[model samples]
Target: MASFKIEGGHKLNGTITPQGAKNEVLQILCAVLLTPEKVIVNNVPDIIDVNKLIFILGELGVKIEKLGSNSYSFQADELKLEYLESENFKKDGSSLRGSIMIVGPLLARFGKGYIPRPGGDKIGRRRLDTHFEGFIRLGAKFRYNKEEHFYGVEADELFGTDMLLDEASVTGTANILMASVLATGTTTIYNAACEPYIQQLCKMLNAMGANITGVGSNLLVINGVDALGGCEHRVLPDMIEIGSWIGVAVMTKSELTIKDVSWDNLGQIPNVFRKLGIQFEKRGDDIYIPEQESYEIQNYIDGSVLTVADAPWPGFTPDLLSIVLVIATQAKGTVLIHQKMFESRLFFVDKLIDMGAKVILCDPHRATVIGHNFQSALKATTMTSPDIRAGISLLIAALSAKGTSTIHNIEQIDRGYENIEARLKSIGAKIERVA
Candidate 1:
């Protein structure tokens, strides 16, 4: 495992640009498997998870070309479908959770898709019932091998059918939407996840000649098309990364500018930071935060403690809760962070506690943070990264701590953030990778 040795208690200043959306690019890259024609994607982030998916695609015989540093063209014209049953395929498919998305396009075009039980962060229980159920509802047959932990779906043909997703799971929605686009008739999906990333997927499909309506809403209607053609698509800037930068600036009392934030798609992120009394300005598409001495949390209109919780799109994102919780530790007041989507995500607060932050872990799903109001600083210590978001959150804490700190298992952070050490260095932050 690699480690990050960080020097804390220093203010950083300069501008930083977030990489392409990791979540969105995963879906878009999978969609490339739907058509035999070449699909060009721009602004692809060079993160571990995404690179793994790209490697998988190349292994599958997708005609891959690197057009530029952050652009690629993919064509699935000569895929090695037999590789799906190979032992090497099982190992590759199970290594990353994003591999599950490949099943949708494979099943849609070739009438079969197989995947081993996907592995990723141990954040909590992320079930695959949503993805398989949607496939079954579309006339596909599902089977599982318990001993081998493998899943397979097949059908002579898939016909359109109306279905309701039990939860607004973003990956589930993307998988089902990709499968539905080539069905025999129209498919209506209720309670679909309408996050901006999902919306980008829908728009990309539409660009590729699929008929999809309700791009930004919970209800999506997909009219089946016989075949899909290739189109060039550019990914939106990552909102999660943008929020992380905001937390870094506030915690270190640094003046920072985050460029090309795609202001309109950053639903509830800026406001959530504002709730912590962190001030920022919208300069064109960039967000500029000046050096800050202190900030105070805002109470609710009813004089109750502000509770920041996660919901579907247009609501606060669950992915950024860790950053918010960390940001609250240095604010002037108390705030409650409720991570309802995943039970174990808030468990990382124990690491923050060890760093001398005043946090009360109310339950598996909630934590109350008592800000130090600039009166104290978190002392540096050795820690391990639990997951992607929590790892970056701990890094933010380490950057603002009183001394040098060490963070192991930094691979979790690399799975999401691209070129993190170099980016931090360019912005005047003291962080180094230890081999």
Candidate 2:
């Protein structure tokens, strides 16, 4: 596995562009399987997971042509449906959680879809029950084989129906939406995930001639269509990367200008950072964070401890809470970070605590961090990355620490962030990638 050896306490200054959305592109790439016509997508990030999904699509006989550095044209002109039964499918499909999304488009267009047990970050138990349940409600036969460890959904014809998801699952909504677009009738999905990723997927689908309504809302109405044509779609900038940049600026006390961050779509991210007493200026489409000597956390008006938690869309994203927690270690006041989505995400705090930050892991889901306010530098040490988000948070912590730090399992980081070391190095960050 590759690792990063970082020299800490470097003041960085430069302009950086946030990469295209990783989660959004995951869904958009899967949507290509729903149409046989050519679909062009722009602003695609060149990362491990995205490339893995692209390779999987190619294995299914999707004709893929690279248009540019950040663009690709894909056509499912002649799919090799039998490839799903091959060992190659099991090896490639099990490498990414995003591979599960292919099931929807395949089942919708070819009336059958097969997925091997998918693999991803081991933060928590990410169940596929919602996806299977949605497919079952859409008149598909769902079966799971424990021996082979795969899932299969098949139906001669899929018809739309009403479904209230057990939870607002992002992938679940995207999966069911893809299946419903080619279904026979109107499908009403309540408690749907309305994240920006989902909204972007719906927009791209509508452009491809799919009837979808109530975008950016929890209730979705998808009118089934006979066929979907091709369309060109540009993914929005990654909000998680933007938020990570913000946290890095504050933690390192560096000046940075993040360009074209799609300010309007960031939802509660800016406000949540503001609550932590981090300030930045918005210059048209860019965000300028000035170098700060120190930043302090804000307490609630009732003099209670400020708590940062995750929710669905239009609220704080769970993906960014780790960044918020790591930056909080250098602030002036105390705050609680409640990671509601994943149980094991907070386990990395022990490494942070060992680095001299004051932290209390109250339980599996909550941690209280006491800020150091630049009064002292964190002593760096060697650590292993637990997941993609946690890996970045640890990198940020190491960057702000006083001594050298080494982070292992950097493959987890590369799976999401595109050319992360190269990008950060351009901004004067002291990061060296080692094999």
Q: Least accurate stretch of 10 residues (summed lDDT) in model 1? A: 267-276
Clash pairs detected, candidate 1: none
Candidate 2 colliding pairs: none
RMSD of model 1 against the true structure: 0.6
Please list the residue runs of candidate 1 whose C-alpha ends up more than 4 Å from where it truly belongs after superposition. Answer: none
lDDT of 2 by residue, 1-435 (tens): 899999999999999999999999999999999889999999999999999999999999999999999999999989999999999999999999999999999999999999999999989989999999999999999888899898999999999999999999999999999999999999999999999999999999999999999999999999999999999999999999999999889999999999999998999999999999998999999999999988878898899999999998887999999999999999999999999989998999999998999999999999999999989889999999999999999999999998999999999999989999999999999999999
Score residue 68 of candidate 1 by CA lDDT: 99
Lowest lDDT sum, 10 consecutive residues, model 2, at 293-302
**Candidate 2 deviant stretches above 4 angstroms:** none
Residue 116 error for model 2, in Å?
A: 1.0
* Candidate 1 residue-wise lDDT, 1-435, digit = tens: 899999999999999999999999999999999999999999999999999999999999999999999999999999999989999889999999999999999999999999999998888999999999999999999999999899999998999999999999999999999999999999999999999999999999999999999899999999999999999999999999999999999999999999999999998998889989999999999999999999999999998999999999889999999999999999999999999988899998999999999999999999999999979999999999999999999999999999999999999999999999999989888999997
